[model samples]
Target: MTDLKRLGLHDLHLSLGGKMVPFAGYEMPVQYAAGVMKEHLHTRAAAGLFDVSHMGQVILRPKGDMASLCAAFEAMMPVDVAGLAQGRQRYGLFTNETGGILDDLMFANRGDHLFVVVNAACKEADVAHMQAHLSAVAEVQPVTDRALLALQGPLAEAALSGLVPQVAVMRFMDVAVVDTVFGALWISRSGYTGEDGFEISVPDGGALGLAQALLARDGVMPIGLGARDSLRLEAGLCLYGHDIDTGTSPVEAGLNWAIQKVRRTGGARAGSFPGDARILAELADGPERQRVALRPDGRAPMREGTAIFAPDGTPVGSVTSGGFGPSVEAPIAMGYVATAYATPGTPLEAEVRGKRLPLTVSTLPFHPTTYKR
Candidate 1:
């Protein structure tokens, strides 16, 4: 644990009775004194502050023109980078030559440059990938002097707006750099908890102060990674390395919505990025298996690696992400199954502890998302 990196709020988490554990090379808090169940419920009802600083923060500065930079970036992935408007953010994926996902990320078109956020474990490789590919048109700059914090829930807007009144006007996916006493806050109206919230990047020096101020609010509580995982799972969002990875394609992972039509086979700018052949083919002709939402019959949670079986005892797929959804009050899961069984209400069985347990394919998002659109 000594070799693991620590966030700026490490001491603050310890003070709040957070149970520290290793995650993505960081010694992060998995749960606080309130436990994962209470923390999960509290965030759905109120606001939960999360320390997500371990995730990578990066900037892509254009050398010539924004259009050229976007073009250069588009060469790496099958996304419509040029179509993104300023002051807005969108979900993105880094794909390998074989059309498999290297990582999933969020990028914001910040007028002059792009602000990108990648998962903690893939930061180094992601930065290197960008530099290796976009060096001619953009400067890949890694931001290391900031801490990222997420304030998420129904009350997030009320709590955050109390300190920074300007943030109240921001809608979902809106990104802005607001000046505050704590310093310039690069804020995005988005989060992974399927709630209305903001992801704020504050200077390292002001990280603790801003966290303390937010925690001082009436409904804000300190949340840890345990609750974070459950919250995202309930939302039906994919976690990198688990639900999505280098072996999975965006089309197969049920992320076709993220790829705008412009990049499709018949669209204006079609078939130029890496793995375009395979990705576009998958788009035209459906994939063999697709990611789907799963609901276990009883209270027992079917964890990851649980294999799926057909009605006649034929092997199908396996669970990628699964857990007891605190909000849904039932064990929920997400996995890839034969496209034939991906429909809603399709009966199936999960091999949990070597016994076939009944389950069903359900629509995504075990719980409804309350984003402020």
Candidate 2:
């Protein structure tokens, strides 16, 4: 096998009994000796530290003014970039001409510039896309000197505040640069898990130290990819290549809320983005299919790629993300199905293995979110 890239906390991960696995071109921990189940439950009850350095960090500085930069960015996607207030972060997507999503991302307006985080597998292409499109109005700089860490769960604030008391005042989606002994931490009070947490970007030199310190705190344990996947799946958040991709439109993926009113038809800045015609049309009308939450009938989890069928055995959709939610203690899944069958409590069948299993369309986030809004 070819060598895989390693995170800055590679050694620390091994020392913590992390079982490393290849993921998104990196040798990341799938779970520690505590196992995926314990880690998942711990994260929901207390805090779990995750090493996510494989994801990309980028800085976009305006060549002219912040307004120009935001305008240039808004052209690439249907999001209202210019309206994002300072010190706050918002979820965004990059779309192709057909309104299919290229990649989903998070961008924070950090005063004069924008700080963005993209999926690990799409970072290179995302950065290139930004450079090719926004080069005339903004300087797109990829950050390579920082390692990102996510401290997640209910006790996340207490664990993080132990080191930096300033974090205690931050609300959900709040971003700030706080001085720490390790370095200046660029932190955001956000996470993919349906829990209160923070994502911290620390310089490479201080990554291991900060991770170690966080682990040293009571109720904080090292979490890995296995639990991370389950956590996000339970949260009903779409996984880029799986639940969403270049073939999926935001509206079909249940992400219309991410597309603000200003970008919709009849709004002030409507229809300039790629695929705005189809996207806006879908908004006005409705998508042929829609992403929905699923509750499997039995203990078995209907994993990704599992085909969904109507009660009459007609093919309807396919499962994108699925697994047993530790907190919910039940099998949960998210997938796209015919719009008519996407209603909550609607009966559906998933072909797991060969036999069809019963399932129901349920409300999103099988587990409720506890974001500190």
Number of clashes in every candidate structure?
0, 0
lDDT of 2 by residue, 238-302 (tens): 99999999999999999999999999988899989999999999999999999999999888999
Candidate 2: residue 294 Cα off by (Å): 0.9
Cα lDDT over the full model 1: 0.95
TM-score of each: 0.99, 0.99
lDDT tens digits, residue span 153-247, model 1? 99999999999998999999999999898899999999999999999999999899999999999899999999999999999999999999998
> Relative to the true structure, how large is the alpha-carbon lDDT of every model?
0.95, 0.95
Least accurate 10 contiguous residues by lDDT in model 1: 265-274
lDDT of 2 at 74: 96
